[model samples]
Target: MEKLLKAERISYHADGKKVLENCHIELRRGEIVLLLGPNGSGKTTFFKCIAGILKHSGNVFVDGVNASKMKAHERFRLGVVYSPEKMRVAENLSVKENLAITGDVNEAVEFFPELKKLLKLKAGNLSGGERQLVVLARSLISKPKYLLLDEPFAGLSEKAFERVLKILVEKSEEMGIAIITHERVESVLPYVTRVYSILSGKIVSVIEENFEKELKRYLLID
Candidate 1:
């Protein structure tokens, strides 16, 4: 249960407007943490800051190493992987070629065999769901110690969502995982160990498993 990542008094601003202020978070190894928030609640911004894609005023430590002080590639060596909501694959490359280009072809194929069959197909020709699976597979190939997912379940059918969720849970058991989602929390409630609700750029509340009943009361889910 050691802390793999910690943030203290973090703040960020854009266009002279504050996006996050005095926010704090701690992520322990082998735990699945869900970040729940409405749109523009700063969930995406917070993850980007942690991933070193954005600059913020605060202390972010990955395995006790200051994230801001480390170079982007150095942070990747520490097993921090962030998968944004949008796809970033090369349209001209084949599915397998894209994985190879990312240096994760072997591992990705092992996790998602469905992609293995479509290895020769161009990425641009794949369905949205298939493309997402490739992204998920690639993220796992990084063998990240901390995985940050932004709306990973978006644009998936129920069956596909369950399949992806299964992979996420399996991977989380091996590493720390944080997911930000605005969809129904119930879909992932059973697998989540803790939950943080963000509102207006601040963490409104932190809920643990022990407070399940109370949390549901607050969520108004009968």
Candidate 2:
């Protein structure tokens, strides 16, 4: 597989305190990578930095092209789609319209057929699971080369989690993916090829599937 996204010697600071320091991670095309850390551990910060949502000192490459200086829209055009930590759909727009605005409803539906029926409902009116489905569906319209999702499973029911997980895992073969979550690593363990656990703003651990239990132990929140 080809490497799609790489962050090297990444560091960030705010209010005179370092938020991240000398952190590194790689995402290969068609691969799913996990970013696990406790709150304030720089997980979300890493995602924002890569998506150009925040500024930082580092190098981020997409498909061997350096993209650290690109604007968020430019990065998106380069095939990087970021689903933010908070749900961000039009509250007043119908589901179909939300996707239609992007001009790729059919592509989104190809991954999440269930969205077809919810097309008439406003995004705000959907349940937690349904809302996430809408978000995920809209994200695919970009046909991204890389997808970064922040806490996507939060507030989702067990069944909904499974449903979303299946689509994400399947979609990984077409795009590199990085998902940030603090718990329930089991939900993605089977699909992930590499896991990076962040501690004190650094990637303290990088493990493969065989070491999942240890990784979980290190990141398990009380």
Candidate 3:
């Protein structure tokens, strides 16, 4: 697998307070990697940095291009897509309309056929899980080479969560992915090739072997 992205000695601060320090990570094409951490562990901040939404001291190379020096749109053109934990869809728009804006309704519907019946329904009226599926559909429209997801399965029921994971697994096999979440580690275990444990603004551990088993222990899998 070819290297898709790399972060070296990355650090971030806000209001004169250090939020992340000396963080390093490497992502390969066609790989699914998970970032595990508790709330306030800087997982979101780190993701923002990768998306070029936040400025930080260090180097982030996307396909060998320095992301720090590139604009967010430039990074997007490089196939880096970031989906925040919160849905940013247009509440008034129907599911189909929302997906049409990204021109990926067909592809997205394949992963989440439930959306077909809800295509004409307003985004604001859908359940949390439904809304998330729409957001994910829109994100994948760009056919991004790298996808960053933050707590994508949050607020979803067990069945919905499993469905989302299925879609993620399929997409990840087609592209490089980095997902951040503290729950359902076992659900994502089979597809994850690497795992990173973040603590107090830093990557405390990096495991590449038996990642699922290790993650189960760390996440206290029952």
Candidate 4:
């Protein structure tokens, strides 16, 4: 069977500058793939392309069906969800309202029980970490088959990170996850089934074994 979500020969350009060059990736259910790269490595650009936020030269296949022409909303309906690095929510709306726009608020809270109490609070009034949780919760409630998260651990406290990471591991059983994180790489190392390293908008290597050593090599850690 084809991978749940696949992107092939993905290349992108902006202002006549090539940002991504023939990048490819495959995500399978029951696995978490970690994308590691430094800043300005086209990490965010790749996620945007996969989420259909930006048009690029490539084909995106979802479960053997071509979805390259689908709009962002159309892709969302097809069970592909992307949570950006920055928090995105209606400032004036309450947390519950935000989640309700896509799916059941109660179902979303099941993943982050801490959100239950803050449901009534205006999204803008919450702290950065709280807002991140809301964004993640909303994504989870939609029950997407493939999830692309950009910097999901940003602004999260250690305790909160643990909670979120645990929930993500559990959710990976039902969905394929591709996460981009530059900090605390070791924290996510154990849970990831595959690792991809990108530099200058190109995937340099993919490691499925000897993760720590291989990852350090790409990261240039001594």
Candidate 5:
């Protein structure tokens, strides 16, 4: 399959300090790619570069076109969506209102039926997991072709985590996905088709098979 998003030689500097160097990555439809690294490993910075949020040095192509100079909304128009690790929503707005701001939530609710009952409640009133569901639902509602998620599983119970994972798996059949999560390695291992391990802002290893062993070998798990 042709890659939906391609980034090459991606490097970034912050406050005169190098944060990422010569990073390359690609995403294709119908597969879920997991990005693993410790804190300060430049995972979030990498995602921002792809999403066109942070100015960086690199060639980013979407659907065979150069997106290196595109803005965040332009990238969104091209079907690339990045959800930051810090979940954001209008606290005073109702759950339904937040999702409605993006678009129709019918399909979003289909992916997360749990949101049906909580639609009327204020977004701030919901629990962490519930807020996550709202955020994921809103993202899916946009129908992005390449979805970059940073810590989508933060603040969730085991059952809630499983629910979100299932939704991601189902969505991967139609859209390209990349996820950055630092928790529940065992639970996420089975769902990913490939894994990229990054350290000190550079990709160190990529594992396509024997994830459990390779993850340990790469020191992503101990």
Candidate 6:
């Protein structure tokens, strides 16, 4: 319980093969790690090599330093938040002015209270689940400690994917989550404790018990 995000032995190559060879990930703090794979499994190239955006070989500790010599906005000011997977709002601004350019949304409006009646509409006229709940309520008011979620349930709506796994399991106690999904680990199965799985490129399995019968016998879940 001392890995506030760590990637060891992470490998990658091109022009010659091997997309990611050794691959590893820890991420703790409060917990919530689930990086399944299938699409060129490197899980978004190990979240772009732990958000430093490419150029990686191994080692990427965050809270324990050595974050590839930090850069991506200094590892996002050391709090480290990367919510990609196509999430960017402010199409014309409005959902409370895009949470007022990310200052405070009263705890992301208490983890999205239907975004307080769509703040006042506009976010490009909302809808893909209210614009992914205003780009995940401005990434939960930018209070991340290590968030890094990617495909947040694609286009959510099984009640907004259970209200975004109950607001990232209450923002993972204090936020130290990592969720790159191809979906169906029974949808964040009980806020996932641990589940790796990446095939071809490495980390073949880590499931931490049952996990829906090991994603239906090795990621065949559909």
Q: Estimate each model's TM-score.
A: 0.90, 0.90, 0.90, 0.96, 0.94, 0.32
- lDDT by residue (32-70, candidate 1, tens digit) is 898877788899999888887888888888887778666
Write model 3 residue lDDT over 1-222, tens digit each, in one string.
355788888899999999999888788877899888878989999988888899888988987777877777788888888888877778999999998986678887887788899998999898877888888878888688898888888778899888778777777777889998767877687787888888889998899888767656666344
Model 3 TM-score, all chains together: 0.90
Q: State residue 96's C-alpha deviation in candidate 6, in Å.
A: 4.2
TM-score of candidate 4 on Cα atoms, chains taken together: 0.96
Tens digit of per-residue lDDT, candidate 2, span 81-158? 888766678989999998887658877787778888888988889887777777777786768889999988876778
Candidate 2 clash pair list: none
Supply the TM-score for candidate 5.
Answer: 0.94
Question: Residue 16 of candidate 5: its Cα lDDT?
Answer: 90
Error of 1 at 132 (Å): 0.8
Tell me the lDDT of candidate 2.
0.83
Model 6 TM-score on a 0 to 1 scale: 0.32
- Per-candidate alpha-carbon RMSD to the true structure: 2.2, 2.1, 2.2, 1.3, 1.5, 14.7
Single out the weakest 10-residue window by summed lDDT for candidate 5: 82-91
Number of the top TM-score candidate: 4
**Predicted structure 5: clash tally:** 0
Model 2 stretches with alpha carbons more than 4 Å out? none
lDDT of prediction 1 = 0.80
Q: Write one digit per residue (lDDT tens) for candidate 6, span 69-89.
A: 666777877777777776567
Q: Count the backbone clashes (under 3 Å) in each candidate.
A: 0, 0, 0, 0, 0, 0
Better of 3 and 5 by lDDT: 5
Q: Candidate 6: deviation at residue 124, Å? A: 25
Q: If candidate 1 were superposed on the true structure by all CA atoms, what would the RMSD be?
A: 2.2
Question: What's the residue-level lDDT of 115 in candidate 5?
Answer: 90
